[model samples]
Target: MSTNARQQLQHHLRNARYEVLPLRGTLEQVQGLPPGTTVTVTSSPSKGTEATLDLAARLRGSGMHVVPHLAARLVRDSAHLDELLSRIEALGLTEVFVIAGDADNPAGRFTDALSLLRGMEEIGNRPHRVGITGYPEPHSFISDQMTIQATDEKARYADYIVSQICYDPNTIASWVKTMRARGVTLPVYIGAPGSIDPSKLLRISMKIGLGQSMRFLRKQHGVVGKLLTRYTPENLFDELSPYLVNPDYNIAGCHLFTFNEIAKTRQWAMETADRLQEVPA
Candidate 1:
């Protein structure tokens, strides 16, 4: 990671920049977390967009910055999009992570993110920060051109991006550069897995989407995944540290996919912050 990215990480640590709690029942656990914590919620096709409203309300009531994921794949129509926006307004949520959710097929009238972005505009709802997802590795179901196109178009509607969780820092770095080269300018929040056990993380990854994760692990044929069994994000951080220090890269902060281990994940961040502070100034 660059020094700028490292500094950004430190700042994020000061404010608890954790994200993406799609795991079951983590909403309540994260909502009750101490002050200044950041919790992001995810919406899936099976659960529908209503999940964002319910969870955002629960988290806001607990006095935390709650970011709700507005999955485009689950919305039924334009009016349905309006309802989700109204609920977000009533709940005072200013940020949302928009993505094409994991659905075997389009769940409703919408199948992709552009539809939701257009719908958000038609309804005149603009959250303070809107985020989209980027694929560091090839998406199993999407071509590189389609992925880049989706990002380019989404950038017009989004303020920033939260990339897919990538095990390799080199790949993440390369993807960011490729995006920049492609003229996608939204600031990026690089996704990293938290301090969960590798086995559990792998399982959770598959459970969620595994778009590229299963492919990566399967291609590894065993050695890498075995080593990763004890591995956490320490190595990934080492790869990103330099970029965190570079402003031109527009690296922003982190999006930790806690996989619902909020307690342990938060502890890991706090401890990491302390360790960073203790390092030579």
Candidate 2:
């Protein structure tokens, strides 16, 4: 790696945010993370926003910077949104990541992230920092044009963009270039899988509509085999290092999808950061 790339990689690794699902054992794993670590709690249809908020509150109490996912479709209506925002404010949290969500049907008038964002604006209690999703690779259901248009629209209300977990660094780099060309200036946090078990990672990827990215991984020689054995973000991080170092990309840092493997993810991040900082023999 170039000197700049190495330095940038270490810097991002040091400040990376961890995305964790609000499931059983998540609290304990998050509690084990280094103090003041930024953790984004995910909301799912089954768990509902309550689960995400509950986890975010607990994590915040544990002294971590918590960013909870507010799945638009799961939110009922204006009253519900107000209640959620109130709870968030009560916890002294000021960051949230919004998504259209995976629900087959909307539970309220806010069917998408854009609408939810508008609602927040109307309510006038918006979080200090709002993050929206970006897809480097094509979304499973949304067309490329639509995704691009959606992102451009969402950019107006968002503080930054966090891309979906994509394994291919080239695609991510190209996507960043495209976004810049389109005049979307928000700094982007590249999403990547943490040091997760191969089997579990694959399972979760499919469950969360990452099939296209997984298919891209399968095309890479030996990647499928590696996925069956062990998976790490080192290769992906290295490949994207040059772009991460470039100011034109406006890359913020990494958003590691830890999938609740907090300990392993933390170890990998620390080790990689240290390795990059070490002087060569």
Q: CA lDDT, every prediction?
A: 0.75, 0.90
Top lDDT: which candidate number?
A: 2
Model 1: CA > 4 A from native: 1-6, 20-28, 205-222
* lDDT tens readout by residue for model 2, 1-281: 89888888898999899999999999998877777889999998999999999999899989999999999999899999999998999999999999998899999999999999999999998989999999998887888899999999999999999999887788899999999999999999989989988888777777667765677778875576476465679899899988987888999999999888888998999999999889463
Candidate 2 wrongly placed segments (more than 4 Å): 209-212, 222-230
lDDT of 2 at 93: 98
The stretch of ten residues in a row with the least summed lDDT in candidate 1 is 207-216
Backbone clash pairs in model 1 (N, Cα, C under 3 Å; residues 3+ apart or in different chains), count? 14
